[model samples]
Target: MTSRLVEHLGPSNISGASAVEIADRIRALILDGRLTVGERLPSERALAIELRRSRSTTTRVYDILNQDGYVSRVHGGGTRVALPHSGTTTVDGDDESMIDLSIASMDSTPGLYDATVRSLPRLAALRGTSGYSLQGLPELRDAVAQRFSARGVPTTPEQIIITSGALNALNLVLATVGRRGERALVEQPTFPHARESLHRHGYRMLPTPVDVDGWDERHVTDTLLHGRPHVAYLIPDFHNPTAATLPDSARARIATTARNVGTHVIVDETTAELDIDRGWAPRPFSAFSPEVITLGSMSKIAWGGLRLGWIRAERGLVGRLLATRPSFELGTALLEQCIAIELLQDMPALTAHVATRLRDGRAAVAAGLARLDGVEMPSTPGGLSTWLDLGEPISTALSLAARDRGLVLPPGPRFATGGVLERRVRIPITLSPERTTQAMERLSMAWSDVHAGDEPRTLALPHAAVI
Candidate 1:
């Protein structure tokens, strides 16, 4: 494990790099999720020997890291990783002053409050009963089923199982059908939380590359044929971070290959309906293969606070999911389910409101990227974020610099495994126009700082290629 962390640090001695530089690199690694919180660090003596640096240098590195709240040294626990406390302030003073660009979600839709109010009546009717719906409310299931049918995948209410959210639904699916110590194919530069979920379930990931353009059909098929992973977790529609959608032909080919390999395709459709002038929509991935288990949520289209999502699978698989769910959660809240039923009734208006916000937010990002030199912004047809190509692998440095300037943007490597994708950064299109532009301005300043060498020089993993 220390060797891998050392490898991420690259060749130790640059002409003038010092303990501060080393600490900065490690801090960026932690921020990128390359080194998880609570993971142990190598002893200073051991790290010094590995890096061919003096023990004093290693001590300073740890001291600097500890000062920044990135690590803690217990009596006999050695040094364990940690995140800075939320109350920690930046150079500018208060933490609240920072413009957080990490979350890719929006405020409640214009219809959410009214929908919640409408749902109260239904909630009152369920007050006398147990209120525990393991399979979810019948009305919400039917509404979700109809939405799937409209998306070009024929479905019945029996095929849907509701959960607390998309992540919860995903966890339930994995708990039911996932195999431990097996291979799971995932997209490089995919959602970080999904990667964490897959890891917690004991699946080793075989990552396929995805970029602003989209998937490489050849690479995906080759990986499936060669890796023969037990499962493939995909965000096919308006994929997170990159916001690239898989085309119909690619979807069909991937589905076929996965089916042939006996791989369960878990397609995350959380960002599916966040369309803003994409001018087209592909069929639900399940349409390409009946074996695909699709996850959907109201978090993006409606509000994250709503806490509602559902899974669409074969009735047998739905039963398995229901059986596995109670071990962790009794059921999704009844009131939230009722609100979802009402929200589903007004999806058209909800989606339209989201599209307008996304459109403006996209414009804000484009305008912001316009001011930065050597940064390329892709045409985001329809998604919640714009993936910027920085032309150089300086993303980690840029993020640190941004944080100093009161902006909290996740570096590109945060989206991938093993600290790769340094040439890319995902800027969300979910913030208000004003806040988005402000973030861009701060990002511009941070970009200048990175090029000026205010932050340490970091390297991507040698074998990890940015697509």
Candidate 2:
């Protein structure tokens, strides 16, 4: 599993060229698998010595590599290669294993489409066309409500209003609760798309911090009780990026606080179902505050292509959301609704399959990342991306380095909760076992470089944040 990266630009010949040229050489090495996963690269000092170049020139070279996504930087440590991904191919035709730590959610089952057609008769037989109902199709409402009830919170069809996806559900909640200029509180490093929706619709932001260590209970309690945000978006179940779930007690406390401040707490349970090891069955924060609007989706459980999500709310606000549906998404596809119902009926089988695959994938990535030195990851099993503490400040450079190798990964700021994590990255487990292993090995190389103080070695980025 351990290998040296010597694809091109032999160390002795790595001098008197531009930083871009040096970066290209390093990138080729990674792509060609000269740099294996988790291998600690030579220090900046050692590399400069090897290449017989000034330390500054060596620094610029690493900076270019960092920007291009071939390596990661750690403050006071050195740099290491980044985890590889699907399209990482070298000029020599050698390919680096790719780890997809970019997007959340795994691909869903294939039979889902056929399942929808089978359920159409009951809807079509309504003696006429099932015209648009602000409230979703009666059948889907029952199915969605039943899903919540089955999960523990008892509810009826009247409580469910199906929408386009979790994004739609959040929009409805924000529009009903927030007005422009009033602050809408959200967890820091939340789903970016949701954040964009909130911003585009004219709501100001008040970010509450949360991470893999768990919800920043005190900060969240303060934000809800004192900040007076019109609405507080809560992802108490398996948070994205950080993958931190609110413990049951904290969930209740935060809900109580939201009620005290009159902020409608909007709970997004998108990734709560994608846990690989422990059951991701965290109870909704709404259990403590039924006044809270809880958003659920089949996107992660099934496929993202299925654009169906639902909101469970108190009847009054639910009606407002229903009225606004035509302005945005008319409704969850009538046919998709039918298909979802069929999928729901056979949910146990799909659930078992998902749980099994996720378990294997999580183990594979977690084990691979653990092999790298100076990298800290939470040992507790949950969520899609592994929250990694890289022990240096060149996360941005690392991402750049990764890109040069044709392995695009999310930068540290992509997951910042009010701007604290920098020497970190989210190594997602969505890739196959072999790919994840390869990615981790590259990561080790990047970290080795970071520890050696050669990360972010480019002059163009001296004025820029290296993330």
Candidate 3:
């Protein structure tokens, strides 16, 4: 963990900026959960040598951290990350010092509180049953199935299985389909948690690159043919982090290619309903091929705390998943299912509400980024985040600087398995216009601090790479 932290700190050439810079990097690690409460930090001498700074500078940085309540040092005990009450804390925990941009989820939708209150009467009727539904509540499944059908993909209740969320759905699929050491093809810069889930289930990852303009069909097809992966995971619409929506033609070609290679394409549509400026809604990927498995969630569209997501697959596949699900857990929650049913019943209104918020957020963030001289912000039509180019492979440094100003951002490399994309960072637009403006202000300040020693750098490219 210490070595990893050192790598994330990157190199600092400006000697005068070493102490504060090192302190900021350590604070960023703690806030990002890379460092936790009661975790002992490396010795001051060792860390100073690793950061290429003098021991006195490192000792002063530690002194500053101790003064700020970010770390505690006992007489004989080494320094450790402080507890929440002591000063440092997690994002959702008590501390309000830092603003979290690491998560790309939204707050509760407008009608959620009312929907929850209204669900009580309906939920009271289900108190008699055991509430252990291996598949899901019949009404909820029917509602989810109808949603897919309304989107032009024919679906039935028998083809839908509710899970905890998108990650749970992905885990179930991987558990059922993946084998140890087998290749799992995925988008180069896909969701970090999804990639972690695939890795945890023992599948070797095979990455195919994506860009702001969207996927390269020829490359995707060639990789699928050559890699012969067991599972291919893709986020077709308003992809996470990159915010690129795959074109229908490319989707069709990729689906056909995967089918030819006997690979199951798992299409994640968690961000599909967040369309702010995309003119038309494309048909679900399953519409192109029956082999395609689609995953949807209320987390992004409605609320992250809802913890409800569903998988749409063939009836036979659904049965297989249901049979295998109990081995992991009994079933999804009943109350959450009831809430999802209410949300699904009024999805049109809910989607409209979120669309308005996202539109304003996108505008505000875009305007804010424009104020910065070197940052490059992409034009994202619909998604929770916009991928930004920082002109050089200093994403880690910039993130550390942002942390010093009380803003937390996940660096670009977190989204990819390789270190090739260290020049980018994903900024969430799910925040309100006010918060978005503030975050951008802090980000600009951090950028200035990082480039204070050198001239501001800029890169002009045809399209931003996905990962």
Best candidate, TM-score:
1
Model 2, TM vs. native: 0.73
Report the Cα lDDT for residue 117, model 3: 90
lDDT of 3 by residue, 1-467 (tens): 34545644545423456676667556655655545577887788887777677899989989977876778999779888863352333332243456678877778998999889988887899899876577899999999999888888888999999999888999998877778888999897888778877877878888888867788788889999999999999998998878898888888898999999999899999999989988887878999999899888989888989988999998888888988998989999889999988888898899999999899989988999887787788888889898888788787677666665667777776676644476889998899998888888878877887888532211110111121
Lowest lDDT 10-mer window, candidate 2?
458-467
lDDT of 3 at 198: 83
Residue by residue across 1-467, what tens digits does model 1's lDDT show? 44656755655323246898778878877765667788888888888887888999999999998987889988787898887765543345343476777788898898988998999989999999777688899889999999999888999999998888999988998899988999999999898888878988989889999998899889999999999999999998888888899999999999999999999999999999999998888888999999999999989988879888899999888878877887998998898899989988887788889999999999888988887989999889887788989998888788878877777667786787766787899888999999898888878888888778676322221111111
lDDT sort, best first? 1, 3, 2
lDDT of each prediction vs. the true structure?
A: 0.84, 0.67, 0.79
TM-score to true structure, per model? 0.91, 0.73, 0.81
**Model 2 misplaced regions, further than 4 Å:** 1-100, 110-117, 120-133, 279-281, 417-419, 441-467
Cα error, candidate 2, residue 436 (Å): 2.7
Judging by lDDT, tell me the better candidate of 1 and 3: 1
Best by lDDT: 1
Clashing pairs in 3: none
RMSD of each: 4.4, 11.5, 6.8
